[model samples]
Target chain A: MCLSIPAKIISIEGENALVSISGMRMNASLSLLSNAKPGDFVLIHSGFSIEIIDREEAEKTLEIVRHIRPIK
Target chain B: MYPFEQYHSKALCQALVDQIHLMADRPLRFMEVCGGHTMAVRKYGIPSLLPDSIMLLSGPGCPVCVTSSLFIDQAIHLAAYDRMTICTFGDLLRVQGTNGSLEKAKTEGKDIRVVLSGLDALEIARQQPEKKIVLLGIGFETTAPTTAATILTARKEKISNFFVLSAHKLMPPAMEAIISEGIPINGYICPGHVTTITGIAMYKKIVENFGIGCVVSGFEPLDLLQTILMLVRQVKANQPKVEIQYSRAVKPEGNPKAMAIIEEVFETVDEWWRGLGILKASGLKPRDSFQDFDASEVFSLPVYEISEPEACICGDILKGLKKPQDCMLYGKNCTPDNPVGACMVSSEGSCQTHYNYAGIN
Candidate 1:
């Protein structure tokens, strides 16, 4: 049951943050994360924001995959 | 486009598959150590795209699948108490114990609640202060931190009725156990979510000790294919190292705050895995400071000796020794609607995933 989705934080109030996954909004706890803020994307697992997603790193991975030429 | 949808691009996945097909020259057996990875691989038909030389085995990753029957039996026993409410994940509802499942117990009017998160269980405790709430904690490191957080919240809010029957397991020790048991695995597709909390250090240790490559992967088509391609490259170069293909969510050091919560609330001990048996320091339990929240300590429950069904090969399937097809009851008797074993019960489980996506394009 380790399935988690990347959710963007819409707002934060104390240890709880309102995160939007796709179009659905839910409350996620920021107790596990130190620097999560509004508009930042975080991985939500079991009602908690486990980690903040690194957008730069994500784009870099996609960019690297985009450049991989298929072997003939 | 949604930020996570980029990893699901069909074109990127095909490219990685093409690269894997071109690079996989020799026979290599790789095992994915996460149930989420297993589901994604089957759902995306990843094996259909790969060369026959590259074999992928599902590891003992599904927490529900690996949980011993005794744990289920104990939970069932606890459910018999009139003043007790057993809060568990939805997947655990149908998993059969020695006598019956929690679903069966619920039908017989037991106080069983299906909670999505441990915090939901705490909320149940807050709502029903007259009854005791015992959360059936089952998962790897990806989930343990959340349970730890729930316990801390219970203490902070003075929720005395909340308890956790922790069946939480660690991924690295189980990985090490599989290797030490002489499983013929060349590389590993590590659990992406677990690594988000534990980081790559444990995987680095696995690579150093067993000289096998590992790739922490996300649960998507492109992610699995890319991870497989990375592992293939490592095998081709004879260089075993740990890589993070899911670097967007997982970092090298992982989530230190999450780790800190887990360390504060729980301690490792020998745990029983259905297939792997008891592995040392593989299970998590609430520490002495949190003993009041520990279900095992809070209640003196009777130990019930339980055995796996004689016909089910879930244990073998978990060890990567057999496939779901190898089990005679896989389709005939053990459909998801009526699961005969733990593997067929959880959606992330190999048997259930195989049953659902079998022969799919």
Candidate 2:
């Protein structure tokens, strides 16, 4: 029940925003976010965008994972 | 590939698995206190890849699974009233109370509706001015904010017919209850989405108070593997702290706007969980100011004594003491199609997840 998916905001109208997730577009409420705008990737949970996904941090995490070599 | 899809790379998952196998030399038990993680762990076949010494236990995190039977009974009782519509998430429809389920009531000519979000319940209220719309608000911190937003919207629009029967709960108290139960837990993989709203401060308290390692993790194969590796590293070094493996979505401070809305609308109260019993201040209810929208307050309903089904060990499974297969009725009588217990009803539930992915039947 706590499942949330990452989506990109397509446009904003009042407190609701049109978000695109893997090419599927839907409306998400921006009430839980303070400064959400178009083009921002956010975690959509139960119709509300809970948090803005940080792109740099995401890349950094992948970079760290890529550096993990198998222990010989 | 999308940015999130990279976290599911098989190579990255293998690397983390290798690292975990190498480092985890001793027996270590870790619990994931989120239903999403429970499903992800099993769906990704994480246990088969990990070392034999590391045991992953599913804690009481599935909101639908942990909701007390009395609440369901009360909701069912409310559905019996004429001109009263009970709106809830789809998962709650099949969950059995002592007497019957919402799905059963629906078949008997009750006005029960399955809604995707709390706002949809409010919309129903707007459409049917004569009927009273009661939204069964069930979820943790991740979903409570949406319910709060719905209530705020209802208040703004002056929707008097709208109400919420809040079964929303907080995560930390339940985690503390589990730790206090003297379970031999070495580390914790915290709920990532809940942390996105509540932040890491509560986890820091857990680490400080209990002296255990905790990593807030995302629900992906690579993410779960990396989190296990992080936990193993913490146990090996004997230095326990709270870390965020899902930093891309979860922040240390969390979403302040969401917190403020929850604070304004709801207040902490004692709530009943299925297996864990009552934890002090673990549940959320509308504040006295919003009593008009509070379903429990608006409707004077009889509280029914809860009676869990016999032979169902969902309680022990939820407390991390037993697996789904431990129950005699697990695969034989209690399957997802016909769930005898609450744990078997929700897809995110440990029993249901195990049945679906583990192929233990």
Candidate 3:
């Protein structure tokens, strides 16, 4: 149970890619990754890029995803 | 520096379980409205962690689960046409129609394509100008904005070859339906993705009318636990409120730009749901401005009231009226290999989630 986050593509490996979400780096599968380039934001889910996240909206969602728990 | 190590942290999970136990002077019924939450709760054993004081039931959160038989049949019809390219997300492909499914149509040499996004369908239309590209546009608020954006772009480019069979739905109305029916739901763990766009404000009416606690949670073990804790706290206090436990992605006010785009291209209309009948003004249809992209205008589907196949208790499973095991044909007659209904076929389905994660022995 995880929310799909819009992350930046820092680099790509064969069919896999490295994405940066809120300065934290993670790897996601590119099985559904298409029409996407290095600068594009994508809604990655379960080790795959399902859809390209809108940049402005992605940034906003990141703001929320980065801090999901109540501010303690 | 921000302090959480893992997303939906383990500390949150334990704390949530502890809180639920604290409120367990008696048994409580809680419903997780998103199918993703159902899978997470089972995967993390959230239900088992409780001291029999809390009961979590899966709701009709899976869009594929709620999509009526008519929509599936229409998709098969479009796929049967030689010049029609029916593009859809993966979940809908194997969903059975009256006679067959899109997967069956594809096997029969129909042009059925699986797309990751609505834009992928748009790209197909751009590439195959000679063929009519029909996208099975299904989902709640989260996916609707993308579909709306695709239509906006298509209309701007005058892509007459592109059309969408919109089965898109809204979430809040469904939540209301559950409470209104008085299905013995004490609280709600709202859908994270849908609230990301529509915001937690959508559940205001539920809190006001039914006096049930609504916590919007992410699809994670810890997220589910924390949300359950939130619900328990509200229950203990005897206060009905809406809170954002998945605060990382949702706010009181949702994505304005996405809302604007959706409002621009689509309007709420009375639509049919599978388990729940026609929910008045609960579905999204293309606005008059984008009438060209409305598949209903271009194609005429025969009115067919197809009967649901025998022993498929998907409807009961969806409404929280029954569990997957309660069905006469849960694992015996209807496994994933041979799905008698949509719930088994769709990966996000409650029955499939329960079959996979929940100890259904």
For model 2, the DockQ equals 0.81
- For lDDT, the strongest prediction is 2
| Per-residue C-alpha lDDT of model 3 across residues B245-316, encoded as one tens digit per residue | 766556567766668888999999998777788899999999887889998767887766856878788888
lDDT, candidate 2, equals 0.93
- Model 2 pairs whose backbones collide: none
TM-score of every candidate: 0.98, 0.98, 0.85
Where does model 1 sit among the CAPRI classes? Answer: high
Tell me which of candidates 2 and 3 scores higher on DockQ. Answer: 2
For the predicted complex of model 3, DockQ is 0.10
lDDT of 1 at B160: 98
TM value for model 3: 0.85
Q: For model 2, how does the per-residue alpha-carbon lDDT over B1-361 read when each residue is reduced to its tens digit?
A: 1567888888888889889988989999999999999999999899999889999999999999999888999998888777999999998899998888999999999999998889888889999999999999999999999999999999999999999999999999999999999988999999999999999999887799999899999988988999999999999999999999999999999898999999999999999887889999999999999999998998888988988988999998999999999999998899999899999999999999999998665
lDDT for model 3, please. 0.77
Better of 1 and 2 by lDDT: 2
RMSD to truth, every model: 1.3, 1.0, 5.9
User: Per-residue lDDT tens digits of candidate 1, residues B107-133?
Assistant: 999999998889999998999999999
